[model samples]
Target: MSTTTAAAAIPAGRTEPDPDRVARGKPLAHLDGVPVYGWRGAPPYLRTKTQLAASRLKVTAEQEAAPLAYVRTRDYGDVPLHDPAAAVKMRPLPSSTKARMAARRTCSQCGKVRPVVLRGRPCSVCRQRAEKAEQRLRARTCAGCGTVRELPYPKHGRCHGCRQEQLEAKRARIDAWLAEVTVCAGEGCTKRRGSKKAARAWLKQHDWLLSPANPNLPDSWNSPGWPRRCTPCQKAHDAEQTRRQAENQARYEREERERRERERREAEERVRWAAAALADPGVVVLDTETTGLHEQARLVELAVVGSSGDVLLDTLLNPGEPVGDASDIHGITDDMVTGAPRFSDVLVHLTALLDRKRVLIYNKWFDIARLRHELELHYRDRAVREAVEEADPAEVAPEVLRERAAAEARLQAAAWLDAMTFEDVMIPYSDWVGEWSEYHGNNRWQPLNGGHRAAGDCHAVLACLRAMAEDVPAASGADEVSGTTVGEGGPWSRCA
Candidate 1:
């Protein structure tokens, strides 16, 4: 058995060279055992120039055994190796430590990490010391009545009760002082003593000398003032005077303009009323047919007969809604009104044509109510609904609902023809017909076609009016005929 002893080696206290210094030197000649180019005089080795040059040409070689090198047939070939100096050096990776180190410095109030310079400083502590100092100084002496009192902050400068009493005493003193001094009698001027002296100096500069003639003159009057009054009072008084003059001028101009407008309006009104009373040259009788007796029912057809008794305008309005039983009488259908403009669209044209024109209908009340109802519905007025509900239906004669609908169709057509009302040119011929019949000892009036058809009914009304106009003749005088019309008879009169 062979025994091996472990020997104790001596420790070398050599330190590693600084990396920054090594980088500043020449290229490395060798790292570990690999051959490389570097500064010859660096680190552990130092050699003469001749020896160092000689070492650059020397190469190391490994010796093989004589028998292996001389083999008759060499099956293995030597491979060229890459230079060790050409290999890249890799840096060691960073450590994966995850612990957090506590900071030495922190804010006093919030315990947050603070910079070294701010460790002991606190804003709240400094503020408290400053406030305490201020409180002490303020309490050292009282501002009012010269009395000393202990109070917090600014209030320490004075005691509350003493301050109040001192203010009252000072006010009384000032009032007594003011009472002894003479003041100018000028408006809003209450200068006294020192202030009066300043005012007198101002008057002297303005070259205004006190008049010996007027002993009771205001101090401001001692100055050569503007033509009106004292300097202080002049500005306000002049401004007021100017304002009043402007207001009076404006009032007069407004009154003149309004008077002219009134005269013009009155003149125009008289002309229009007179023109409307006279018969228009081209008048057309108009009427309508509807789906139902109610005003809510849509217009079915419209008809218009010219003053010459010609059919000027006639058309069917196919209300988008159903016609129901109305179709049996007028023979209109939904397909007929499919492309027609809504009532709202047509209302503008209708209103223009009827502007200031009186409308004639067989039953004026029923036609007016239905037309007004449709207008209100299209316009979407709540007030119209209220008015309709409050209206007396009996007076309007609900019995004439269907007939009135036909009348409205006619009126709409006639308005489209000439933009005139029946009241403007046409009077109720039925009254005259009844009067004629009564004079001939006949009790009954002429019969009106009941069913709602646009063309037929319109023609009937036109014929009645024409026949009456021919028989009665237009009056030359302005006096209105009374006993000759409806609603003019006694309680039991046949005409009523």
Candidate 2:
């Protein structure tokens, strides 16, 4: 059936193609009332476009087979089809078609139209003759400079020498305006012009040139109120500006002195407060075991030992997740902390135990920062949990809560550290041992027993601090002599 009849027979809603039914390489035939044929259903004798071409039955524009219709997501409609024919007769190509193909191989030089072996070039014989003739001509005389020089193969209009001379003459015409003036025409100035181009560039950079029209005339430059001074005058002008800047700096420094003095007094007050608190029996040594060395790592264990060697607070904390690699360092694992209270659960009691007492920490900055981070996470998680519980518990996403909590935790942790101070045992200990430069070999004081675990490290810091306090009077704040002498004999050798 024809395409019009086939399309009319299709259902109204199915006017567009059936995507699933659309296929490639299917045979073209009429079946019952529809026009669709499967590739397997075709006879062995009937062949496709490729099969027909393989047998040398050329199918071109004029000898095309009837088109076959097919359906796709949208109706692709019909495509031209080819089939095998008996007693195949190869027709002659059209004259116009032959002419177009012949034109593609034609050469521009030799007007002789023939089947060219090389597509664009003329016959190789003609190309060889032309190359030979070009090689015979050695040099060409220049028209502009009248210089004769050997050039490349094919002789052309002007030589490189002539071109260069023309370019230089054009540049000279362009620069003719730069040759008239010699020295600065400004009042109280004596600087002479250097190279015309350099002087012009310098004037432009300094904004001394008022107009570009007459650059050679210094009278055309600017002096109006502003410093269009010569080189020497500009140096004097710069010195004046520097002196004024120094005066301004002095005035600013005077204003800042009062504020500096006020800060110094406040710092002294903090120091006195810290010293008095440290003298109390409640003063504690603190340390923590963290997931990793990173600032964001969760705390897995905390231990606080009092100044008199009493353990105040020592606990393993369930860090909400697994106890990370810190388990290796502190010997606290996820299984060990499975029944332990979280940091939040012990926050109130921990705060009460340490309040109003100075804390001595080995590497106070690291411990205090990690402590603040843990506290921030505790508060942030609580906030998220409360919000989720009040709203739809089932709809709450844990990941979303975690992201919001992390941001809040970061901001709160920084603010948390600002409110508290911890005495750093590392500072005073390092001072007593002298700098690493003063200490020879391994004689410099190291952490006692190399204890990284919280309870053990706390004890170590306390021991070091006690040792430092005893040696303070003899050191007089600089113990270089003993520190260097003890060389590899160890920190205790000085006391011995």
Candidate 3:
């Protein structure tokens, strides 16, 4: 059915809306005897043009199938709403559009079809040829020596070397008259001028006098700025420049040698240290994966591997905090560690394991600081629990008691940390690798290939130690270190 009024004309082929579906949303008004609804108030049968477009569909033209109704939206207000059933799939590009695109792809100069739009310029190949031609116009071979080089004057080409020789000839006249060096070599007449200024003015007159002899020679040599030097003086100047260049080259080579020797010494020292650490029964590799890198970050996992390849300890430690932001990295979530023991529960066992032993940790400083923070938290919680149980209303305020507890906990935590011994494996490894960072004034730290988990990272540290302990050849030097290549098989090799 079709409806036409002065206000609007209803389009045909609009699917009839079910009354049951109509009950879903309240229809606004029958404006000009046609259904009208606001954005959220439209019936299920009604789809706006945007909704149709999103589905790769278009509303059929008024001649084909008209809109079922209208929807009033905040932006682009009162757009027609059509039944999706009456909408058609979007049509492909027309022949005129294809022709226009083809024209754009055709190069303006070469007239060849290109992968990209030429944008009024020639294709890449034609453009390159044109650029080369322009370069050739601006450059020419020197008449002397025949080396193809850029010349300031391409028409009367003379390379810098040849031009310098010509300039020296002009300067030789000045030196001849001044009695600084050799006699004049000016053609036809070899008389000397009075002062340096008189000689320069006369030189220009001489160029005009002898213009036919050197018709192609540039007039730049006749300028006042032309540096005057005799034949012997020129030889001495060239010799000084050559000597200075030789000295600079020697200095560079000396510096390079010193740098290489220094690095070799450092690498040998690192290897020795690694060997010592490996031989010592006290040294053990330790690693931990935590909630975060922050001081307050709690451990999600902890592991220790003895030098003798014994797995000393490996367990998950629940921090009782949701691993929301950091779970993606270490892949530990709240559910995974829900039943695991807290840091407080594992403190005594950890202390026992590390007693009278040297713990080697990758990035030891950060991990130790993190461990101290955990300890502080544990003591604070213990103090708070004890304080809460023995609280008296008359004694002090709750906040004041809590503050005192925290302060005491920090002191105890510090004392506990002071007793343990640790060494940074990352520092020695970085020194061996020898990539200097100017910002830090130290070697750049390498990433731990096996650091995704606590146990895996412990193995990675041990692997690094083993790699360092091996005899490094002097010739190969410490050019580069790769996590995968250095320590072939271990937890580090898992990724490779």
Candidate 4:
């Protein structure tokens, strides 16, 4: 709303001159029909609102329109300029004015009136007294003299006399100990300190262990475990300790090397044993593609690959229940296993393959638990009740009987599981892979990367077995058949 134009009040097109600017003899600019003046540019007769207030005068409503103008400055945007003649003196208030002013000048602490008003009530004398008292309270007591004293280093807690006394006592102790100093440790050189103040200074220069400040050895010259030897002896002892430390470190490193070598040899032997086992035709590699892992899982597909890389059995199974959340993992669905054989139907063939043979399963607990769960489901079925019931094992209703059969199936499954001497290839493979785990205190189980499929994992286990048998460096099961993708090109490329 404020503008700064040239000092001339008239515009370029205006023919007429501004009469007010001519009368005042000061340049004035017009803003939206009102006169505008720069800082200190307004005529002396005009005063701002603050100036009017300082003069105890105010412009009334009647003086509003006669000569309205604005003064503009850089600091303040726009100020209303009024004629001093138009302002009236303000009415004074009538309430104990002198008393209030007197109270402000009076110091409340001592009731003394000063020329200027006191700040925050307290007088200088009271403030000084409080500061001095606080300093006195904070001053330390000298430990030896028991007198309060101010010190540059207050933490020392000792005055000049006490500190000097302690220093003299330390010198006395040093002189006494110097008399007892005997053999020097300078390699058959018997040079010893002369029992004098010079000897004490030499001890000080070398930072000798026997000092009055040390609580243990400084009190008596013949104290047990005292360092009675000279500086050379101390240095020699330090050197001997350093040598022992170095020897111990070297021995520890050598033992660590031997331990690592032993572990390496052991891993190699285990791998060799694994390789020989895989080469055996009796060993079968078992793998399963289940709905989920470790809990409430039902297998959608099961597989077994012979040690020679022959596919002994590979079949999809109708898990009866939904495939749960693992459809993306093994790509198994209700549609894929709609007409597949049930676990009960496939049980005989699976048993025949595993029967009395050293069963090799990758992550055996997961697959075996899943198979056992499936057996429980099979026994729980009403159709199997006729077969499960030999002599009415439980005297209960059909439902309860099925439950009892299911319970008994656990023992049967345990016996069935015990019949096969299964070895989890994952543990051996992980050991060969050499990925240790602090949490389990064993080598971490390596991921198969077997494409999450029953057939793929079977090939993965078979490949791992062959690698260990043939002395391959990387024993990861994922590297199928000579570290290449299983069917693409490998030693057992077409065998599967």
Candidate 5:
């Protein structure tokens, strides 16, 4: 509640107005029918509760405020105030006021409470003592001159001359310890008046003996076969060992370099051979759709298409196991291959188609490993059948006879890999483009019509090879193949 606006009119003759002065004896703001002065207008003699306590004045909340002065605000029309003189003072100090002030004073340096001053500061005595200690730390006593001197680098509170003497003494002690023991038997050893057994034991514990089998053998007291040497002999032996190790390491590094060079040459030759075969009419692009990518996964469909768009072989195979999750990738379900011929049945046909041809497969490492594994499985089953029939010595079935013959021929075919090398098309393609993309997924390389199947992938491989070949320059006069240059472009394009 605010005081009535009529209360804002003060008695005219009481005081003059000054903007800088606070609202003490002047109206500021009215709050709930009383005037209140802002904090900025407060007077020193008119104190708040905290100010009064800090002044050691006793004030009670029950005592009413005295109207010793008037305060006003816009929020509160009129307010009353109290004077500091009305409060009771606390008891006197324990000592004189000046002594108490000196006791409470702190030195800037060393943080000690002292009633001493020099140049009007409390730390004069402490500063003088610290300067004397620092001067002493800068100098050290010399062992040779027996006089205090400064060192190049302070260590153990000793000067340079003292440090040199200490080092010489340490080396002499080490020399005495060395002379007391022998490292090898064949040596002009230094004589010491110590027990021979104790010397030998000490040498052994310190690994001072050499062994032909264990190069770092330690000396032993009762080991007759072990050889011991003096310090000089040990030094010579260590030097010789280090030299031999350097020679062996150099020889090993040279041989490794030669081996890598030979491998590089051989790999380049193989790539050249594959590129030459690519131009031949017998070269075929092979692709297969398998149940999965694992070693156990079997082929569901196989495609062998010539580079010139000739379909040599395309057939669905009953892999003898369920297709499972692979059906989604190749779109070849169990129902599709239910009555299809098995890989064993088509072995003869496949080998005949691939016999003397340069088989260009995508990712040949995977396809070759898988093909060999499948053949191994077929041979294992045939061997079991042969072992069972060996007791009766009955006539072998023609199908069994054909499978055994095909498996053996294919095993021999592994050797022909030198001439009819199964080249992976990805090698040359990636070398030309410097990158790879998915052939089956929706990407730039993926076909608009079909992919992830044997036939579709075979066509994709052909397109990729043709694209790479096109980048090569054509030969002098031959233009039959797009990039078939006699000396310029061949079957493969060289990266720029």
Candidate 6:
């Protein structure tokens, strides 16, 4: 009978309720007026169950996807989550909340509160007051009398009396130190001190060590006696001596060169006088232009015209060297004479033309000097070489050799100015023409058309000669035209 009451017949498929749900209890819906379960609510319950299962699956997936130790919660509109701990207590309002909160703050410096109505910015009275106080503190005060005083803003901190006193004290200290000082043994050291200790201190300050034998002297100042000079002074003196020596050497060389030139010129002048005596022509004009005013400058161009102002054998001779300053005045560019004949090529023609013809020139000394140098060079190269080659070494004695050399040099120098200068011919011609023109009431002695061109210059000289010839008085067997009066048709009419 005890067994018969058997546990109400259990259904074959039925099982026990979940143990986890029994422990956790059923979850409640957030919506209002919703039942947990029943027939009328069965559909919703089933649907909720299905949705819950799906939601559970999503939550599980989210949890799996989320970073470790992270939690997720649902949001309810307009309903804050109740914190269990806070719900247990009831606290009073804080003091900060009970007071009327300030919208605009008051300035600490000026005690002025800003109005809430003003929107842009607050007042800066505190900052402005701080800046003005700083400026006042920086304003000048008299240092001597300790009184506040007005001064230029730039010099606001210093008073005139204090500044002057500081300068005077510095100067007095410097003078005192200078007066007590002695020259140091060290090179270029002019430092002074009052005592041996101070001197040692100074040497130590300057990183100098005292000599072992002479404790007063620095190691670098070990020379036997007082130095002839300090390093800087010695350097300057040596430089000056070098400069003076260079200058003296230059001057000596210059004087020697000038002496040689003078001797050559004298010999050339003698030869010119001899040539003029032999030729005895009516007129000869010599002209030359040079590269520079130095003895070494080469001749660029030369011209010799006759009394009739004719260029007897006019030729452009190449100097065989660079044309320098001479081209500046003469306009003889290198291109103008590139294919011109060399001086050596035209020398024979030049010499033949000058035979029995007086030489004339302006500034004869300079012209002759340059000519002499050029001719001497050519003659030595030509004649001296020939003589040396033809003579026997055994027969050429020392005296004879010397004599031959001297004679050749003289000949070379002579050729430079033989009937080839203004002094010998042109000057006399000019004088004669001038006098004759003046006598005839025609005082145009200078070359015509300013004489810039060579042809123009020769024409001027020819004109003068013609005038002179016309001016000559009639002589026995002279033409009637020459004897005619000045106003009549005659030589004078022809000259005019």
TM-score per model over all chains: 0.29, 0.40, 0.49, 0.48, 0.38, 0.31
Give per-residue CA lDDT, model 3, range 184-225, as digits (tens).
333333343234665456556767633424634332344353
Off by over 4 Å in 1: 1-279, 310-312, 381-427, 435-445, 472-496
Off by over 4 Å in 6: 1-284, 387-407, 415-456, 463-496
For 275-360, candidate 5 gives per-residue lDDT tens digits of: 45457788888888888989889988988898786788899999999998999887899999999998888878887888788788
Candidate 4 colliding pairs:
275-469
lDDT of 1 at 66: 12
Instruction: Report model 6's TM-score to 2 decimal places.
Output: 0.31
Model 2, global lDDT: 0.61
> Weakest 10 consecutive residues, lDDT, candidate 3?
487-496
lDDT of each: 0.47, 0.61, 0.72, 0.70, 0.62, 0.49
Candidates ranked by TM-score, best first?
A: 3, 4, 2, 5, 6, 1
Across residues 389-443, which tens digit of lDDT does each residue of candidate 6 receive? 8888688865676567657976866955655434433443333333345456642
Model 2 Cα lDDT, one tens digit per residue, 1-496? 9999988997887667555344444546553333554433333344545566667676565445342322221344332344444326467779998877777667657756766644667776688888887554434544445565566422334566665665566446435434423354345665654457754565557663333222233434333432345677667778989999999999998877655454334333433443444457868888888888887788788898988778888888877777677777767878888888888888888778777777788778888877887878777877677667776657867777777767777777676566555777664455345435444633244454535677888777666655544543333313335432211123541211
Compare the candidates by lDDT and give the number of the best one: 3
| TM-score quality measure for candidate 3 | 0.49
| Whole-model alpha-carbon lDDT for candidate 1 | 0.47
Comparing 5 and 6 by TM-score, which wins? 5
Number of backbone clashes in candidate 5: 30
lDDT tens readout by residue for model 4, 283-311: 88888888887578888999988887789
Error of 6 at 227 (Å): 76
